[model samples]
Target: MTKTLGRRLFGFGSSGRSAARNPGGATTAADCLRLYDDAAAAGPVDAELAEAAAAVRQLPAADPGMTDALLALGGAALARDLPPLALAAADAVLTRRKGSRAAWHLRGRALEVAGDLAGAVEAFEGYLERTDAASAGAAEVTARIAVLREAHSWRQDVVGALDGTAPGVGALAAGPLPAFEAALGRHLDDRLAAAGPEEAAGLARVVGLHAERRRHQLLPPLADPLQGGTGRLRIGEFRNLVAGRSVCLVANSQTVGGGALGADIDAYDLVVRFTSFRIDPAATGERTDIHVTGHRGALNWDRRVTTRLVFSDRPEDWRQALRTRLVPGAQRFTGDDSLRRPLRTVGGLTPERWPAPLTCGFEMVWLLDFLDVSPRLDLIGFDFFATGHHRLAEAARIAGPSDYSSEKAWVMERAQHVTGPVIALR
Candidate 1:
């Protein structure tokens, strides 16, 4: 793969680099492109690719193949979980060719990963302007723009509430203001009618809270607000239950449906499943020892499941889930936002280099490792969307913006080196 990509990129034999080097042994465009291909063939975190990207960025804008190299480098950076570098490469291409639709699309994805939701929307709009509206690419971009716009609006509202800038937001800190809550509920209902499934869930949460007269919990607290006295198992208690037990994390990938591994899955000492997961006695097991979910969607699990973990980096997400989704008398737990990506602590990456929001399936795997699940941790239906099918079609829609490529790479690397609770991708 490396040789083929290198040859195609440089228009030379894989072993040939005659024109790639300059008279003074300085790097050339061909050299940088070849480096990029090599790095891409390597894993997601290749030092060579980083160095090549830096060298490519330094090349003169007017140099031959500079735009092509930058465009390719931008995509490679995104795949490698380096959003800032990807954004830089996209900007470089746009500077050279303002009408580059591919560059705009790349910029949109990079910005989204970097948490610049509004910037991402603008970049996607730019891409739309250059694309044929009737084309499939345009249709996909249109859907993406809608999702980003909704996310951006939600973020703005949450920020306003947090900073006490929105009208009546100041009253939230004091306690529930019935009048303000009623007004917000009406507003959310109007938006929910037009929202996509993902956004509608959040909007519905606010409306539900208002209806239930739990308006005071609509906004997230400034700190970890869950306590031991709240009918939740403490960290030690949760560890004691599953720390050394053989665990199986069943994802919603379609591959599991074909494996007929229901009995095999049930064989594990503890079975963990995600939100809205399906149960087929012949394909997916019916047991649910632990139910892990994100902020979105209503809880749907067997009543016998004792432990439920809500995973989200945003405080509002888990906070809302606790109020709206948690089943009464269930053992509740929430994931720490600091461990959401683990790029900074585990991979030695800066904030700019982290990937986009991960799926709950991947988060659960990481959480188990963090919680010291021992002996062996088996994974099923976790091909990272490689098969292009999910047990629930809505899940695919909800996870449309997640960075599955980078997550898959990270998991593969973890499986190789993780000692305790040795990962086994079944």
Candidate 2:
């Protein structure tokens, strides 16, 4: 991939400064068009193209008003499949308007398509925080963050181009390709890891906090606000409503076979399932009394489910999606999943301050701790290890039992304290 990026990124017909210099910082709409046309036509005029690129780079530095035109040029470059150029254009815009949410989004999009996942994550983070908590496609951006966080978990096997070359982060721009860029990413990871917890956590806060920040609902305390304390008024009331009724937590594990125990699960007074996970009455029974999720992807099913919800991340957005579906008695989780935050911490994960981990099954089990119920907590479809027959394996294909070992140990050590009689169906 690094070789591909270099081969495609470099080799621009010999060199950028080969022939003549056109002098950069030309501020004009015509200059933008000329640059786009020159690059798109793929002529052998490296000097002309280089000069044009240099000129585009000067747009934001020259004057603040060029942001709009630079944005348009960046959009054009993206449409033409020139992601690097698009990034440059967006960077130019950011230089002038550092807090420009649109520019951050543009940079994030370009970096993602260009295979710079780390840069993409940073840019997207900047965008989310720059935008005032409410914007179009925020859900999609949130989902993208959830995925990129997962990608950052694994290390890349990188080798320099030269036989016996020492690995260094600086070599990313000058090394013999291979996984040079990915090596830069690893180097960044290593540097951050070595930077001590305080500095590391600061950067992490930038990435994680904005991704799935739980909007605190500090109205009136219901039931001590320290135990079984939830943000939604309906949820607090539901706890009183359900009182001592038994609640079941079901996951989409191979054990369930897509609703094979629908009847059994539905028998419980309250049934909770994860986000985007479907339940067929024919297979698992359709009693989605309460749904819990940490993904923004659940935004798509807003109108689909009239059942109550408990969100960890993007809770504010969920409020808008389920506005009509919500009733006065419905409950929500606005940053009150105290159980989830600690679970991620145990797994060596910040996970965006929500239950937005690779597999939320364990988090689901732990979720029972936060509910306002003392009923029997029967768990189904939870194969602590992924080495089981999952009825809906595809839903969790990208998700694996990566962190199950430690999480399992955590559960075993404290299962007895989980608010009710714990029973594992698998």
TM-score of each: 0.41, 0.34
Candidates in order have lDDT scores of: 0.59, 0.50
For model 2, which pairs clash?
A: 235-331, 254-389, 254-390, 254-391, 259-283, 259-284, 260-283, 262-284, 262-285
lDDT (tens digit, per residue) of candidate 1 on 278-297: 77778887788888776675
Q: How many residue pairs clash in each candidate?
A: 0, 9
Task: RMSD for all candidates, in order, please.
Answer: 22.1, 22.9
Off by over 4 Å in 1: 1-230, 299-304, 330-353, 393-397, 416-426
RMSD (CA, Å), candidate 1 to true, equals: 22.1
